[model samples]
Target: MKQKWRNFMTVLVLKINKNRLHDEEFVRPVTDLLEDFKVVDYREVKNLDFDKVIICGTALKDNEYLDNLDKFSWLKNCKKPVLGICAGMHIIGKILGYDLIENKKIGVEDNKYYLHSFKIEGLDESLEVENFKGMLFHPEVLNKELIKDFVNLT
Candidate 1:
């Protein structure tokens, strides 16, 4: 019997925190979900040629991780499939000229319990499969005036 060769999808995991890269609970689920795909840390290599890239939650404050933004900006030019979760979304917004504003009210300290409704505009109806109700832990928000080209997949 011959073993079948499965096309592997490479996903770039952007390093956010110095400690999180070591967290098994955080890393395990993602690798499990993409069973056939390989998860590679973006920080390990200089040049990347991947099928898709996912930007996980990382410290993306201005001047905090300013250097990382350049890499993401370059990724945008690649026009490959990219998924930015929380901080990832903010990075995309910033790259598109949008500024993130801190929302003082309705803020939650715990990372487990902040849920809000997001309206997806200018996206294909097929993409809007369900209303995304998930734990949102970001203090920054996207400025609509700046992100005009990218479709909002909320």
Candidate 2:
């Protein structure tokens, strides 16, 4: 008998929500768009083997991940490229010494308005700190092609 190997790229998706309901709104879309992905809570991400990391966003009111910033300290020393989405952007911003501006928004409509709604203290349209990069907007919703291209490029 011979052992065979399958060539599939795996991308790690760090879930930022405390409530599972938000998965359909945030996590599931990214996982569905990718050919291969693994969704795990942010706290359990250390020592995992992944080609890249995508920090998934959460509901507008879900700030549970913010309470546990220590779990994300590993990101500072991580060599692999990391892409942070909405809520994930705040995590990256907080880890990078940026101030988090929390706002109270009711109801879910089109999120495109969020792009211009609030600003992270010192972040910009594109983030390139050391090896990590982040975008304030949701690429999966705004530009699905970029996500697909990223998978192919990486």
Candidate 3:
């Protein structure tokens, strides 16, 4: 018999929660998007050996996760492609030296909204997936300058 795929894909989910209180905020879409991928917690983050990594979204925006931020220093030097959603984006912003601001004044409403349209700047059209219009949760806000470190990709 011939083998088609020889490797397993594992994603190390860098959870920012201090306890299990915010398990729901962790990335679940990762499993839904890839059938052959494994998502693990941050138990061995410093000694990790994963192909892809996901910095999970959080429920708090007061920078509470900062208590555990030191563990994620690896992110600054990580070479793999990263996708930060909501608070995850905030973490990435924090890593990129963006000051955390109070987005709480924006109010709380995480309901999904239709994304009228999006324009991804650099990705090839052939690599495009169906663009999602509506966001399912209230996204955490970061400074406008956070885009500087990113390519046409963020």
Candidate 2 residue lDDT tens string, 1-154: 3222232678888998888888887898778787678899998876568887889877766677878999999888778778888777777888888886644333334544243234477555457687577766777775666566556664
Candidate 1 similarity to native, TM-score: 0.52
Estimate, for each residue in 30-105, the C-alpha lDDT of model 3 and write its tens digit.
3333334445454446555765555555554334666666656777787665655455555565566654444332
Task: State the C-alpha lDDT per candidate.
Answer: 0.41, 0.72, 0.43
Which prediction has more favorable TM-score, 1 or 3? Answer: 3
Give candidate 2's TM-score.
0.81
- Candidate 1 on 1-154: residue-level lDDT in tens? 3222232555555544445543353344334344244454545546576665555444322233445666555754656556554545555556655555553223354332222223123321112112211113332222221111111221
Q: Which stretches of candidate 1 lie over 4 Å from their true place?
A: 1-8, 38-45, 59-63, 104-154
Query: RMSD of model 3, in Å?
Result: 10.9
lDDT of 1 at 152: 24
- The whole-model C-alpha lDDT of candidate 3 against the native structure comes to 0.43
**Winner of 2 and 3 under lDDT:** 2
lDDT of 3 at 85: 47
The local lDDT score (0 to 100) that residue 27 gets in candidate 1 is: 41
